[model samples]
Target: LLWETMILPIIRGNKLDGYVLGTKLCPPEFLPRTTPGSTVKIPNPEYEEWLSNDQLLLGWLYSTMSSDIASQLMQKATSKELWDGAKELSGAQTRSRIVYYKAELQKTKKGGMKMEEYLTTMKAIADNLAMAGNPIPLPDLIVQILSGLDAEYTPIVTLLTDKISVSWIELQTNLLTYESRLEQLHTYQTDGIQANHASAHFATSSTTNRPFTSTNGRGQNRYYNGRGARGRSRGRGGRSSVSSSSSFCSRRIVSASCHLFYKSTTLFHNLGMCPQIMKCRYNWSYIKF
Candidate 1:
């Protein structure tokens, strides 16, 4: 009666140290017998008690270690190698804790820890790092671990795919387009003024000694007089003269044809190679091939 009166208050006050003493006072087999029903159905209360204490101790240890590790990771501002190593260690520790919790949860017949709880904790850590603007480099490793967990516990592939797709988009958007700049240059060159006033004036003025008058009211003298006009007229009238030069016209046509061919080839190559373009296509079977 005295033991009950003294110990009951201690247990009621939630003093686990005193409760341990009380548990020790009872015979080891006493708990299993009082649990009721078949012997095989009874839990090992002592082991459960030890596991509960161990879980508290391990949780504290991991939390303290994680905090220190995270601090160390943040302390080295310029060393990518150090940061990567720290991130790997952090992932390993978190994965180990998850594995431990998963095993413990499986042993329980009722009210076990859920995988969602672990995922929430992992996501919290990852989000915190992301908010800091320097996410961990081992996201692929983390995804692999999460994917394995999903396969064993639940299907989280959709969530993983969503995350990876964002990164893929960012990567693809940063790719350089060489053909685009080349096509712009080609268009600019082909459409630009081929000959200027300086070259035309030199050609006309060199044939005559007369001073010319301005014809366009811009105060600049026109160079072509009667002699210069006759020279230019003869130059334009004959096949051997400047205007009817088949070589120049043929060269221009050849250049234009080459430019068109190159532009078409570039467009076809980019269309076939572009990831966004490749996603749209009818199969050969759909085309009756």
Candidate 2:
């Protein structure tokens, strides 16, 4: 707020206080002519306005500095003197700050941070470097940005570098695009894997509860044949009565007499049958054993 509302306006108005004592001393045009032999001299016509403007600028400069800084510049009568003093006083600090920011840039990395965050930090460091009289070139800045990225971006970086001239803006756009594509690919693969797992589970369950199987003759199957099928119990005279239920195999059995026969029962036994939301009857025997 201070910079925009006060400092910028002051600078733009050409009224920013700075050293001008030397310029003030120089004659503009010619000093008013003095009588030929008389020692009396005429004042420069602009001296009054010059003195007025200088004092006004001087006051603004003094008011803007901190007490500590103001004290050091108190003796500076002109705007230029104050400015030079301030720069000389802050030069060491500025150099140190530049070093700190450069070190941070060198050490910073994307790591788990977002791409935007990393780029923003790098830009800030670059700006500070420029302010410190060490402005980075566009290509060098782009290199620094790429160097700080995570290892995951290596392939993309390689691809981009190989294909086109690398610019910071272009790299940033490509990186974001790549990130979105990776997220989509991961989501697609995850959904596909879940779907396949669900399919396999349904198939296994179907095979396990098959209506009838030769390996387990007239055994306890969830779906029963409509035909009166019989099974021998453990005892010699033991009798097995078959009952039908629509709770299971309701879709596969359209009629009480309908039966299912697979071309490769063994294959189905291992992999199970595909799950169907609706069952349909196909050619098969409703045989009596």
Candidate 3:
């Protein structure tokens, strides 16, 4: 904005030709003596007009400056001196800004922030640092980001570090992809658990409602508990007339289609086999005794 309004106008008007060419086009001229014994130094009309124009331009520059900054350029006798002073001050500020950005980058951490938020902040700081004249190396930047991630990102960090070389854009893409996959994995697990619970509940209710058959000497029919993979029995139906025995089926071996039945009072699970209800020849009963 300043260049368009102030600097461009001065340049177009050839007002800054003397400064650019390093030659004084409007030289000072001495005035003729008015008295024999009086000594005076009065500038010629053209020199006085040039001095006034330079002063006006310098005042415009100072008008936009802070008090402290203006003070530094106030003593400059020419436009070149003032321009050089302003450039030097700008260079110093740029260096200071670079230092500040470097410090901020070092202090950055993932902490409780999301992966994307942290990465964006790191990227913004890195960009500013580069603009300010302290560009961070890609490898070092990758290491810094990996080191600051939370425990949840440990797997991705390990994957990245195990590789010999990685580019910044590739690293960014991988991190975002990893985060998206993690969210999908988490959602899948939660949904799987809910589905399992619903399936188990439906299986239990259906099994309980179906008829059952008992294989004991007394020939009593009864229903079995469907809450788990355990077995229930009454009296053994062998010729020796042995008392009934109960056992639990291993959950690892059970399938979603597993349903309870009895074979000679020896609960079908005792066969150490997953029972197929549709293939068994036992009679069905609904009594819950």
TM-scores of all candidate predictions against the true structure:
0.17, 0.57, 0.50
TM-score of 1: 0.17
RMSD of each: 21.7, 11.2, 11.5
Q: Candidate 2 regions off by >4 Å?
A: 1-22, 26-49, 63-72, 193-289
Model 2, TM vs. native? 0.57
Estimate every model's Cα lDDT from 0 to 1: 0.39, 0.58, 0.63
Worst 10 residues of 3 by lDDT: 241-250
Q: After superposing candidate 1, which stretches have Cα over 4 Å from the reference?
A: 1-251, 254-289
Ranking by TM-score: 2, 3, 1
* Clashes, model 1: 0
Better of 1 and 3 by lDDT: 3
- Compose the digit string of candidate 2's lDDT tens values, residues 107-202: 988887777777888888888887777788877777777787777678887787576467777878888887776666556545544554554445
The model with the greater lDDT, 1 or 2, is 2
Between candidates 1 and 3, which one is better according to TM-score? 3
Cα lDDT of model 3 by residue, 1-289, tens digit: 2222346465548656465234655566667656787878776888787777676766766676779878876788766667668777867887888889888888899887777898899988888777666789888888988988878889989999999999888888889898887777666545544544554555454445343455656655455445544355666563332222221212321233233222222322332232333323142231121
